[model samples]
Target: MKLSYPVHDIDNRLLLPAGTELSGDVLEDLISSNHTTPSQTLPLLEHGSVRKDIVKFISQPPYQLIFPEKQDISKLLKQMEKVQFVLPFLRSLDYFKQYDFTTYNHLLNVFALSTLLAGDLIPDYEERIRESAAGPAHDFGKITVPLKILKKRTPLTRAERDILDHHTLAGYVLLSYYKKDPYSLTARVARDHHERNDGSGYPRGINLNDRMVEIVAVSDVYDALVSLRPYRPISYDKRSALEEIVGLAEQNKVSWDVVKALIAHSRTDKPHYQEVEIPSEKRGAPPPGNVYGIIAEETDADASGTSE
Candidate 1:
């Protein structure tokens, strides 16, 4: 396989230039190389030109709505400015930006929302920084998924759905095994964000107790619900989207505290958990069904149980 852009080592050194053929042996050599230190991308992310662009993006219309309070946005920006950027995180973001820009934008939205939510949910500063960076990279495995499946204007077949669901495991392996990320938390979030408290999520059906993983999970689903898709024209409104997540919380699929943090950001009135109630009759398609219809046999085990 060949990449559209250049590939960099963990030290920000060039490993392969644009259009370089990536043979199996070459990939093995790159992955096996001993480069475990943090990448130089940290300074670039914190004090570079990208920081300015991020400031502009989060301050705009839709993202601005996520942080209604200016002080909240200011606090998040301060925290982001001190974050430590890693090689796999940068490489993953670059791949998404070049191949699938829609997913890239969605990741940015997730990063913004997750960081904001972290301030309220995660009390520790170091953990907050980790959560902020992990947000955009949570779907890093999606880069392995074909662009056609990602941009399909119709329902996914059983085979196609299987490929899509494998991204979580793929991402974990890429970051943990191949890239050898020093911070294991990022790799864990990549694997566990799709997991649920009730053991219903895909790739791995284990119960998730990690708050950072849960934060990313909530942000991931909320963005999927509210964002407009090419296949599905109209997305759920803010209130309806929150209600859908709340319904999941009621089912014990996700954490109430994480969901409530999202509600506080999105809802201006009655954002408290006690006031937020599941609708008598749930609206919209249920989970991945609502995001994109799936066409597969009910008995297909691999495709049977995938959540957002």
Candidate 2:
């Protein structure tokens, strides 16, 4: 009988029940030949459940080892909140980059903040947990993208934007192959996270039914607000970031209720979203007294190695 691994985790560590090493190209081929989509997870698993050996592999080692930082993030919350913060993100981000999540801590931070805000939108804390995982992890496919392309000081050419947008689909491939369950929140996030309220979004212009995606979308907007990008130098302060998200709700990009809850979180100072303004598409600087700082170093082939 053929064994089934968690298709959602295909992009992470390679495992033929663990203790195996494969080159990147070969691993890509292995997954490509057997690519799965979130929509396919249920059918695949329904066809057969997770293999015991595969479960054994996922529960130990690299998953447990390379992810100490994610664990650190998880520890900040209590049991229910812990599930909301870690489990979903752990599964969703596996494909893009797996590590301690030390730098920016953007994905971890976004997941925690978004999930807490989104919990009431979805009933089962477990399902909400799945949504939390998919939230920041929606960008995992962008990991290998060259920093120059992402942070170009000038407007991105159509080609550049198109290439950058592929991260959504790339992320989809990463999550779908492992889980193959369309009903799962992580699957929905990968396939439809980029979708806009007015259908201007990319990959697929899906009008998703899940409220978790909407809740996560608000947090997604928040993370972009605080992050430093080449297109915009400063991200918004907490109050301004909250206002921007609220504006997005007025523009129909996110739900009004989600915006209200996020704003409350901002008042408490628990969230650290990226601080993007949907109307202006500009990032705001850090809110008052925020110790948060983001820096990038660029290397030019022609110039001497100075600070980027």
lDDT: which candidate is best? Answer: 1
lDDT of 2 by residue, 1-308 (tens): 11122122434443333222333453465555553332222211111121222233223432232123445334323322333222323443442223322212445445555656665455576533544556555665554344555545655554455556666655554544444333456656755666767665656565544677777676666766755545555656555666667666777766766776665444434343334223434454344433222223333531331112
Lowest-sum lDDT 10-residue window in model 1: 299-308
lDDT of 1: 0.68
Off by over 4 Å in 1: 1-62, 126-128, 177-179, 269-291, 296-308
Please provide TM-scores, in order, for all candidate models, with all chains considered together.
Answer: 0.74, 0.57
Candidate achieving the largest TM-score: 1
TM-score of 2: 0.57
Q: For residues 88-113, could you state the per-residue lDDT of candidate 1 as single tens digits?
A: 56666666667776686677778777
